[model samples]
Target: MKKIFENTQIAFALKSNNQLQLSYFLFKVMNSKLLVQLGTKILLLTLKLHLPVQNIIRKTIFSQFCGGVNEEDCLKVVDTLFTKEVSSVLDYAVEGKINEEEFDIAFVKTLKIIEFAKERQAIPFAVFKPTSFGRISLYEKITAKKILRDAEQEEWNRVVNRFDLVCQAAHQKDVPVLIDAEESWMQTAVDSLVLEMMRKYNTEKVIVYNTLQMYRYDRMEYLKKINQEAKQGAFYIGIKLVRGAYMEKENERAEENNYPSPICASKSETDENYNTALQYITENLEFFSLFAGTHNEISTYYLMELMQKKNIVANDFRIWFGQLYGMSDTISFNLAANGYNVAKYIPFGPVKEVIPYLIRRAQENTAVAGQTSRELEMIKKERSRRKQE
Candidate 1:
């Protein structure tokens, strides 16, 4: 098969020159670690102080990375991706709320998104973070094997009930709901809840998908165990595999608390582990639904090769690829153009509420060596190509 990711024309088809130039400037600023760190702190403080910075943020990083402030605001983004044969996974980007009422509101927002997904063919999945619906302290307690107080027990029940409500809505709508993975300290509870939902709704097909962050050293074993449970229980398991996003925080916490780090020793180890999990899931495709959520070219190409070797059809719903909105368009769009199943994780929320998510994206881009440079190079290449044409 021909290499599809290098075609810049398809990659940037929706980006106007002005938008491309803005991205170039943003990535250039993000390339400087000091600038990203300083900018992130200043932006967060300004947003907190109710300053008049939303307009610039709305135009720059937020517009580049997020879908919109609400579902209606995301329609243009959904339609543009649909035109390119790509699909969207609507993710409400609000996070870190500790109030029960806030959790209930997030649950209701999730149901609304599911109803929206049911009506829109362009939206392939609805996604939510487990922490968004549950208390982080409760999750940490569960992970630490601690007993909960009666009040805490009631809170946990509320969390479980919220998850059930959202999953039930998705089940009724015939839309798969993705449960995003968080830090390892709180992941066990998330894992257990996702499994419960899968057992309930995934008897025939995978309606509740659990994400596995392959950067963890023990995840391959976890994947094996989950696959066994799914097979024995006669239920299909949905797995979305990613390299993980909390490497720094995870390591820092482990060091501060004097625990062995759960992360893989190196990027190469994570890559090996991720590829192994992908191969195992694909080999047992009958019992698992695989979503390769990645931006790494090698991992993406490895998946394509695995599909070819396994004889998985190009358009198989059992296998799909995903990239985040505003990043990795070269992979997302070109793969969709080549008839591969692909979707983008399109996040949306009020500009101020979503600043943390946007800042994290910027920081990650800064930390990843050559990431912003690569994006800049590709944008420049496309612009030059267009000018020549």
Candidate 2:
């Protein structure tokens, strides 16, 4: 069972000797919590001071994590993955914008990406964030049941229009689009909008996909209700399932608000919830399609085992495995090699703008027990095997 993820040669085939060394160095640095915290501050400060550190950042961590700063820049990365039978989920990684102009810009960029995906066999899905298309305040107010002023209503309309534009393009181009999940507070509005898009575009098939974060204690029940709604509406539901990325922030918010936390009681609880949701989806396979986004070896193998037990083919269109770029190469490449439908979440944006994303990645690696250690161990094993050759 472990051998599926043990083929480091295929995993590292995309990296050169020097690139491998740099990745090893980066992961080693990320393994230290103190260094990652200190280095993150310094990196942001230097960037704010207009220091010319982008080159160094680009060559090291950025090169490993991001596809590039723009769509054209990602061509080579997509091509390389296609050679190994892996598809790319092109993600516009820009974050932290509050203006309408920026939202419109990201919306246009997403449309262009959908159009780009229409022609590229290597690119299978396009992903964007709801916050990227509108103001957080608008979503928050809507979630909180606050009455919107006329001006605020206009702004919310614009956001809804932007979402429609992107989803419409995806539907027209026959490309699926993933709407990323966010904090639980604002997720109600996001869910409403994504379902509206699903009602519009998912009638024929699953063109609009919603991300489900299984770390939330209520999501398994939520999935059941969503599935029932989809069935009642006679529309297919597309889901990208993950264990969630904002556990600490979510718990902190719940504590600050003096409310019970929505997070699962333990990691084991989250894992069980995720597997249960997957089984539920499998049971109703005719009404749903799933993309399992995880780096956990046990979960990946469990999905494979589920598919096998259910007599599903290795390359079933209804099931997919995903990991982020620059990490979990072993899982991604090996899955693709074994004829599983697989893709990596390839993030791209300006180096400076993507710093937040990179910092979170580094912090996650450090905080998630044994994540960096496991990566380092695999990289060292690969390098050793190469040397022995």
Candidate 3:
């Protein structure tokens, strides 16, 4: 990979104009009303039939968010980013599907990704959502205090087969796997699965990571307990944390279901716990591999500050920074430019299979945060700069 010719990561992290540029891009793409409308239309069509609309989707949302439909397809985009010294995490984004036959297919696809990662020098990590292989409702029932029937047990066995295949592959190939956090109700099941994987595969290298969503009021304590379990089990721990993407959904469901809301009291509270967690993890970096998944400028800067103050080396394998595949390019680009270990979570799947993801991203940006506006501002800035040239 060629060295970045423009602003480096530290420069981009340090500068005001760079922050503005980053904010601009996030707001624009996240806020693009027209693009959202078009995407909605395409998503609806996707439900009716498979439209050979790869080029259109590719140029629009896929270009912004996904890596590619498959490995060979991802090479050019991967190579382009490599030129800027940026790396990628392979994410096969198909979600919300499960059947014995279909689960086997996804299991195979996920294994192929691990194999592909070990074969490539550029790809450093991979992510998997367990729901992609099993029924979330089944997981919910199992996790809740509800007693499982024999049929549910049979179903869970199939799910376990699908999950074990992926984890076993990761163990064989020595690729780190991150299990994404899900809704609060199903999270316990996800956590259980992550623990089982860690117990089996994390004896030497941190082979599996579990995402902790700090927006939940309980996660800080939960992380502490999990860390304790890891120490007791004598296994390495891999933790990747984010502020969380499911706050409103979690709250809405909690209200409907008449359960206590799992969300933090305020955004401030979430941010505080998030920063504190980063500090705590960095201080104990020897015991854990910590990945901070954020687009928050302050959080990124604070981690760098902690690294310096604590005398932690930048080359430490336990530390990494990541943003989504399509969003937060400024953070991703600048961080990689500056030599901090960073990666973009590059998602890939058939267009039809990923509409749910697109819809959620749209809803996420549109909610009161002005996320789309930030993205739009950056795209407009880059476009205007090119125009002036």
Candidate 4:
């Protein structure tokens, strides 16, 4: 409400002059739609051809967006952020693995993160994408209510076990785990599985968080339904509310297949839906814990205002503000400086395996109107502020 996010000094407090310049340069590049499109294509091609591009990537965009190559590599970032009263959610950024071995690797990696979170106050949450533990086609099949073959059922059972193991570790460690949302076609099955985890591990408190992509038009109804279920079952619900990440793919697939798009009609409608969900969660804090995840300043302020109106303390345990690491330092750091709970999602993995996630980050900056420019403006302001000092 007081325009707190404008404090560029606090926003860039942890960044060195070099880091600020690097961020500026990166955002300047990201601001060009044509460049981002061409860059992503070239990077993907380079990776596929097994070209020697890792060093170049490691020095540039990878350093800008990712934490490190593994969990231990992320500790420096986790500690540095906590120096500003901001916490870290260690997110394993590897994607597109379809084999049993890879799934097991993700499962084991997640469990390890939970253990790490258990020992560190700086790390608050552990996260995993649902498809990281299983195949997308399998999830799509189950979402469509198609019967699974015996072998597929066995594979699905392993997927469920992976989820349970992570949730159970989180419960034991007193660490909350966030499950990310994927494409619409596969999300129904994921939703059902996450709800089951909530019922199982969230009896005493919110140890599991399901991501709600508020850009989907029908998520309001889903939220209401879950509210009723939580009340009936006497279990708490934890949700990380995001606007969503897969807009172009969602619309294109819907049109190609002759179904209405699940996405909201426009950005304003999506914003309205996100804010509405935020209001609903804030009003029902007794039954819900929220991690407000966004890069949008207005939405961040709206949540702050809601908390003020409700007389909720700034350090309320049931509420948090989050943004991806290497982005939105304005919101994350300034909120932390103001004594609000904040966490940055620190993604780490091998550079090659993590390219897909990095590509999405670049594409997101390109697709979201004005996001890159705003970031560039903030970095420039900080640089100018520092020079005068």
Candidate 5:
């Protein structure tokens, strides 16, 4: 009997034993301590923004993990990814910006990205975070108390303006804009913002997508409600699901604040909801497009199974797969090899601006059970084979 999770194209991509020797070498650098330390200094320089280091970082880590600094810069990478049959979910990697000017810049930049996608006919989608256009204090206030202050209201409105620009651009260009989910404290605001865009722009089609962090126990119910609302309003539903990203921060917050953590109590619970969300979206994939953004082999396999079980085509426009650019080449490359629609979530920005993400990538690799070690072993194995041959 075939294991449902072991037979899909994605599974083959992830678990294949015959990858090029160079494959493991790439993974090793992403997981290496030397690289991590070097990345730290580069990050500090980036934070101070010497600005000259941008090119070096761009040439190295950013080149490896991100698409490019701007739309035109992204085209070559986009074309390369397309040739390999992987799409590009282009995200501008400007994190930690906090001011009105910054917000305005972010909004304009996003609209341009949408227009750029349209012109290329190459980029399927783009994404954004609320913090890119508003203050954390405003979001946290709305999340914790479910209300806002007058000044906060002004900021919120600015955030809305930002969304309006981007969503309008996406609608005009006929591309979907994915509003990324955030930590629990601020997700209420983020969700509300995404809902507004969906209500306005999604009536004709899924021009906007709100991420569902399935690691949260409450999200499945929320997913159901959102779809119900979509049906009532006669709008298309768009979704992307992922196991939570801020596990440690969420747990620490709960410990510090004396509240129950919002993250799944265990990985098993998280995985269960993940599959449920996959099933939910597939059930409606005829009108809705969904992306599974994960590096988990089993989740990808189960989604492939669901497609087949429901008689959906592996190449259906309604379904897609994505992973961070550097971390899951095995899963990503293999999916491309097998003719499925997959993407690399290529983030590019100034090095300092993106260090936090880079560090998290390093830490995530180190923390995943045996991931770092397995990656290291593979690199060594391949390196040895190369030396002798």
Candidate 6:
């Protein structure tokens, strides 16, 4: 494919001069490892002390990385992105809730977003983390096959009910729901639950998407295994393929517990695994619909090449390209400009509630080798282009 991602004009078309400057500043800050570490500590401390810094955060990182404090607050962003032919996936970014009430709230919020997607052409999908619907420890316990006490079994049932309710609503509304992958230790339970949802709701079309963090070494085989299951069960498979977010944590836990790490041994291996999964899914489109959640331009181009070689159309409903809101605008916007299906994962929640998610975004940018630098480079180019204009 041509080097379409280099077109900064189309990429930053929606950003004002001020917004562009803010992006440049944010990436510049993220590019510094020591600054990110110190800033993360200070921000966490501020949040802990309830020090009146919400407004500052809301204006800076929160505004750049998130859509708004709630679903209603995200409509303007949804409409704005839709103007560029890019759709939105309204992700409720709140995390670490450990109670039944909080899980129910997440369930209701997901249902509401699915209904919103049903009504609006701009919002194409809804998303939630597995632990958001339940508890991480509960998922880990189930993954380990420990027998649940009556109370634990009851809690597990509620978790399953939450997943079913959200998937059922999405299916009824004809909206696809993407379930995010979490830590490897708890992911087996999530994968099983998501597969059950697929079997239940995806008999005719894909309505439930399970995310595969391709950084894990075994995901390609897992993908093939699920493909076999989907073939046998006569259901469609919806996948949101991502390189992953929890590498450091996964490696640390594996070392501490004296087990082999699940992550690919190196970034190149992870990249290869991700691209291989992309190729496999594209080749097996009869049973798979892919929502490739990536910011890597080469992987994006490789998928484009696969589509071309296989005679797949750019706008095929079975394929889509996604990037997070406020990151990788070049890939998201340029893909949309080329008539490809593109969606931005617009994370929204209260400023205080989304601090964890924002922190992860910061840490991810810091850890990913060239991600922040690439963002800085693109923003710099866009700014210079505008200055000349």
Cand. 4 Cα-lDDT: 0.95
How far residue 303's Cα lies from its native spot in candidate 2, in Å, is: 0.5
lDDT of 5: 0.76
Candidate 2 wrongly placed segments (more than 4 Å): none
The sequence of per-residue lDDT tens digits that candidate 5 reaches over residues 193-309 is 788888898887788888888889999999889888888888888888888778889999999999999888988999999999999888876557797898787888888888889
Question: Candidate 2 or 4, higher lDDT?
Answer: 4
| Candidate 1, position 293, lDDT | 96
Question: Between 2 and 3, whose lDDT is larger?
Answer: 2
lDDT of each: 0.91, 0.92, 0.76, 0.95, 0.76, 0.95
Using lDDT, rank the candidates from best to worst.
4, 6, 2, 1, 3, 5
lDDT tens digits, residue span 226-333, model 3: 789888888988999998988888999999989889998898898899998998888777668988998777788888889878887765678998888666666678
Candidate 6, after superposition: displacement of residue 270 in Å? 0.5
- Write the residue-wise lDDT of candidate 4 on 112-177 in tens digits: 999999999999899999999999999999999999999999999999999999999999989999
lDDT of 1 by residue, 1-389 (tens): 56788899999999899999988889889889999989988997887798999999999889999999999999999998999999999999998899988898789889989999999999989999999998898999998889999999999999999999999998989999999998999999899989999999999799999999999999999999988998788888999999999999999999999999999999899999999999999998989898899988888898899999888888899999999999989999999988899999999999988988998899888887777888888988998998999
Cα deviation of 69, candidate 6, in Å: 0.4
**TM-score for every candidate vs. truth?**
0.98, 0.98, 0.88, 0.99, 0.86, 0.99
TM-score of 6: 0.99
What's the lDDT for residue 199 in model 2? 90
lDDT (Cα, tens digit) per residue for candidate 6, span 1-389 = 68998899999999999999999899889999899999999999998898999999999999999999999999999999999999999999999999999999999999999989999999888898899899899999999999999999999999999999889889888999999998999999999999999999999999999999999999999999999999999999999999999999999999999999999999999999999999999999999999999999999999999999999999999999999999999999999999999999999999999999998999999999999999998999999999999
Candidate 2, poorest ten consecutive residues by summed lDDT: 1-10
lDDT of 2 by residue, 319-374 (tens): 98999998999999999999999998999999999999999899888988888998
* Model 1 lowest lDDT segment of ten: 367-376
Q: Who is ahead in TM-score, 3 or 4?
A: 4
Show the colliding residue pairs in model 2.
Answer: none
Where in model 4 is the C-alpha error above 4 Å? none
RMSD of 5: 4.2
